[model samples]
Structure formats: C-alpha cells, structure tokens
Target: MEQEEALDWTIRTRDPDFRDWDAFTRWLEAAPGHAAAYDALMLADADLPALVPAEPLFAGTPANDRGAPASRWRWRWIGGGAIAAALVAALSIGMTNRADIYTVDTRPGEVRVIALDDGTRIEINGGSRLRLDHNDPRFAALDSGEASFTVTHDASDPFRVTVGDTVFEDAGTIFNIVRAGDATRIGVAEGEVIYNPDSDAISLPAGRALREDGRGLTIVSVAPESVASWRQGRLAYDNAPLADVTGDIARSLGIRIVGAPPLRFTGTILLDRDPQRFFARAAPLLGVTARHTRDGWILKERDGPQS
Candidate 1:
C-alpha cells in the first residue's frame, strides 16, 4: 500500500496542474522513507521515455498541447509490458531512468565518441558505460569504467555526473572519470569541477586529480594534456602502481594479464593500438618481460639484466 501511494505521488507530482503542495508535504512528512520511495519511483519513470519509439508515441499528439489530459500522454507512451521489461533491464544494471535517457556501452578494447543533444560530448573508453538524461541534458550517470566529458556549460542547469553515491558537478569543465572496482578517479583538464563524495564536497581545478576509495581521498597532480590520452591510443601514468597499469592494458587490449610481476612504473606508455607493442615498451620499464601464451600475456621477472 505504501509503495502504491508512493507511485501515485510520483505520477501526481509531475502533473502541471497538481498544485496541492501543502497536503503532499504533509503526507511526505507523515512517514519516514516515503519521500525517498517516491523519488526512486520518479527516477524509474524517467527512463520510460527511452524504451519505445518516439514516432509511435508522439505521432498523433500535437505539440504544445498543454490542454490535453496527463493520463492520455501517460497511456500513450507507457505500456504494462514495456514498463516490466524496462524495469528488469534497469534492475539488472542498477541504473534506472525515464524514456528520454541515452545510454552508451563499449566492449573491451572498443572506444566510442558520443555527441549529446545539448552539444556536450563524451569519449567513452574501453569497457565503459555511460547514461545521459535527454530531458534534463545536464544530468548524466557513469555506471562503470572510464569516460571523458566535455560539457557545454549551462549555469542555470549545471551539469552533473553520478558515480555511485559520489557526484561530479561541473563548473564548465572537461574532465575524465575512471571507475575501477570501488575506487573512482577524477581528472580535470580544463576549468574546474565540484566533487561530492557522499556529503563532503571538494573543488578541483585544472591540472588536478583525485582518487577516492575506502581509505579516503588522495589528491594528485596530473598533466592537463594527459586527461584523455586513451583517445589517442596512449596512457600517461604518473607514479601509478604496476598492477593498475596492467589492469588498464588488459582492458584496452581485450587480453588478460597473468602472473604479473610487480614493479614501480611511472611514465607515459604509448599503446600504438597494438597489444604487442604496448607490452614490449611497458615490460622493460617494470623490470619484467612479457611472454605471450595461448591464454594471455604473462609477465615474469627478467631472467638476466633488466630489459
């Protein structure tokens, strides 16, 4: 019954003519978690606009038809089966949105460039997933992997990217965000950005980057030119551990790295879009040698002097 009421409020609040704020506020405050539940339902509905073809949904409907009933538009666009299928997809991915959301997913070793409706652009790295709200052009959600965003600023509707509970709010910026496991790294290339990890918010300007994880936030200096190096088939690592570099290489090449011998590596590794070339250049720097096997590349400590 509570869930039903919350869903009702979710639909009702979106109605332009529904102005009963006092009663709605009273109902929301009357129970704990009601507002949260309502918010979740609204978020779920936001993705419904994207599940169906826009032509069939809006063909007969006249533009700027404010006089038409809200239920008419709701039934026209949403069907029970469509909603069920969309819900399943959303639940499986842990991301939900209205019908007007655009999503891009890339396979391992595949990179994609996305031009959004609002003139904002995104470069999605290998094995990454990105979602944008079409209705609210300023909002986006990065579900996993890495992506670099070049936002077309609108101060009235500030651009925001949500990664887990953390939010990166742009102040007219170009930034790269990488999500590996539970850790997230944000690098600002141009202008500045406001990062909110849970309740704490921090401002990061150009040439600065930060990583957040279970331990805490660790800020670092990153060259602005290296912000989206992956787009050019290069990776710039500044004092990064061997394991992290290996993981990136594996993802970028669509190959697994086995028996990785650890060593401190700090330099810009040019991938050249060739897995073998990358391994040849990277192995010597880490005091290791790469042996290509049937399964994948195996890194072993150099048999003689460091290559």
Candidate 2:
C-alpha cells in the first residue's frame, strides 16, 4: 500500500476493533526501518496533531521507475524513512514530555504565590513541592507537601484536592492543607469545608481546624491569624506549643531553633527585621538562649545574665 494510505489508516485506526490492528502491528514490526517510520509518524501524530494533519505524508515517492536501480532506490528510501521517523519521534517525545510535566516548586524559606488558570490561587509553602494538573477539572493532585488554596467556586464541577491519601472537596472555600507525617492537617480560614472522616461527611466551619488522623476528623476552634500569618511576613502564635512555635519561626525566618526547647509566645514579630534579635529578646522570657547560626538561629538554655 502507499505510504499515505498507511498513515491515513494509522490515523483512522484509533479504535481498538478497527480490523487493521493486525496490519498496523505487522507494519510496526516489519523491519527496523519500517518500525522506525511507523513510530516516527505515530509519535508525531500524537505529539503535534495540528502540524501532522497539515503536512503532507508520503510526499516525494518518485513518479517513474526509470530513475535509480530498483534495489538501490528501495534501500535509499528505507534509509530515508528510518531517519525521518527517528527525527520526528525524538522531537515529539521531547515536546510531549515537556508539555505534560506540571511542577509546583518553592525555594527554601520562600513562600510562593501562584495563580492557576482556572481562577484558583495557590500559596506554596517554603521547602515544598506540589504537582498539579489544572486540566483535570474533577481533581488537582497535591503530590507532595503543603499549600494553601483559595478555590474559585464552581458548583457544577467540584474542585477536589488530593493530598496524600485524603481528598478535600473545595466547598467553594479557602483552606490550607499541610501534609505532616502521615496525616493531612487542615485549617479553614473562610467558607466551609467538608472533611471526609472515615469516608463520611463532617462539616467544618470557618475559623475551624481539623486533621485527618486515619481514625477520623479531630475538629477544634483555631486561631485564624496563626494559620494565615504565613501569608504575611509575620508568625502569629496563640498559646501554641513552644516546639510548634519554633517550627513556624524556623520556616518563616529560615532559621533553626536549637536551645533548651522553645518558650511559648503569643504575639506577632515583624520578620523583616533581624530574626536573631527577636529570638534573643524572647529567649530569656521563655528560659532559652538564642544563638545565631550560619543560615539560621539556634536556641539553648540561658546560662547566666538576664538583660
């Protein structure tokens, strides 16, 4: 059959029961050259459908047999076909891979705000990566780490977020989900979110916090400012654990809290200033000592003078 006919057959054979499956398979495995030609065309068709359909297939088949000797011409055509196929396939593979990859990345100690095409806004936390498929209307997969999402309401189609094994249904709400250990910790700042606690619906209102603990949803009233403070350059804590407070400071200030543990603080500190001074001032009150490190701060128990 003509090369154009073969290509057309391949294009039309997207159906499984197209009866030409066997023929296509035969063509695919015919020879290294034949296989290469088929793969090149197939990859091009899959990768650049618009371009492939616009270009003519099998364009330069000689009209007369009087040109070169039959055997030499046939071998030359085979070599040409192989080269053409390899080039197309290579280009197609590269383009397809590049286009298909979705990367949500953040630098260490840097929170990045990204706006999605679908009107959803995402704030990726420092030292985190979230892979998302915006094209999938039913779901956006947060493949790793933590992010806060301000989902644009679309009732007809649910905007679902998948973090680890737990899936969150955006009830047209603004919420922050952090993947910690094996659980998905969630704090809702606006609207309402339905938590699937053991495959059941449990509603959490605004200013509420909960976590999927593998057992069920543990709900509690949370301090909204503390949860949303990362959006700003400040760390707000309301009677939070010393360890937890230090962790938050570490994430925001790009420092390490190494000391006699953390002293509980329930106030806000402007991070634009030296974080070391903040730690130094607070350490005595919390019975800890603040020491500046190369990239961050470390805390240890205070030994002597109180200043």
Q: Which is the leading candidate under lDDT?
A: 1
Per-residue lDDT of 53-136 in model 1, one digit per residue for the tens?
Answer: 444354565766645344543464355446445545553343333355556566677777766678889888888878875467
Q: Distance from true position, residue 273, model 1, in Å? A: 2.9
lDDT of 2 by residue, 141-216 (tens): 6654568888888888767777777777877788887764566677888877776534867787788887665686
Candidate 1, position 217, lDDT:
89
lDDT of 2: 0.60
The runs of at least 3 residues in candidate 1 whose Cα sits more than 4 Å from the true structure, single-residue gaps closed, are 1-99, 303-307
For every candidate, C-alpha RMSD to the true structure in Å? 14.8, 16.3
Which regions of candidate 2 fall more than 4 Å away from where they truly are? 1-101, 143-145, 212-217, 258-265, 281-287, 294-296, 301-307
- How many pairs collide in each candidate, listed in order? 10, 3
